[model samples]
Target: MAETRPVWVIYDDGSTGHMEIPEGDGDPALAKPGRLVTEAEYTARLEEIRAARAARHEAEETARLEAARADYDALIAGGFPEATARRLSGYQGTQAPAA
Candidate 1:
């Protein structure tokens, strides 16, 4: 029986995926335009990719919050009701009172 191992499939455009293949398969369809890597290296790279995605999500959330705050302030300044402003800004009215 042939032993199967995890191989990290790296694409030319810098994307990555994984597959399990038997040792010495070396199929051109799987090897061309993509490099195979050890499981340990694949795991480490996956962690780095996940961390980067998390950081980007956090940053986007922060920006969204900032924009919401600006909209809330503008609504308040325009004499709209506080509850209505909160709703428009995607808040649940449980947020701390605006300064």
Candidate 2:
């Protein structure tokens, strides 16, 4: 059986969590060093970190969608066909039949 030890994590945003260090001493690239904390504190901090990440991801996706819409509109205004515009804008909808 491999041995595991509890360790604290300090996230990039300054949030902290307690996690078990996997056997083989953990991957330095994947783990950040921090002072150890109680299990309860770790759980609470982990929730906060997850929530913050979700919010950030949502914001990024919204921005990307908005930009694609703008690009599609611009392509249409520039005389490109609707199907071509959508394709160039990275849209995944069914293409209209060629007239």
Taking all chains together, each candidate's TM-score versus the true structure is: 0.77, 0.63
Q: How many collisions per candidate?
A: 0, 0
- Model 1 TM: 0.77
**Superposed model 2: Cα runs more than 4 Å off:** 1-33, 92-99
**Native-referenced Cα lDDT, model 1:** 0.76
RMSD of each: 2.7, 6.7
For candidate 1, which ten residues in a row score worst on lDDT?
27-36
Q: Candidate 1 on 1-99: residue-level lDDT in tens?
A: 889866686666556778777888774366447676667877787788899999999999888888888888888888889889999987553556566
Q: Best-fitting candidate, measured by TM-score?
A: 1
C-alpha lDDT of candidate 2 relative to the true structure: 0.71
Q: In model 2, what is the error at residue 57, expressed in angstroms?
A: 0.5
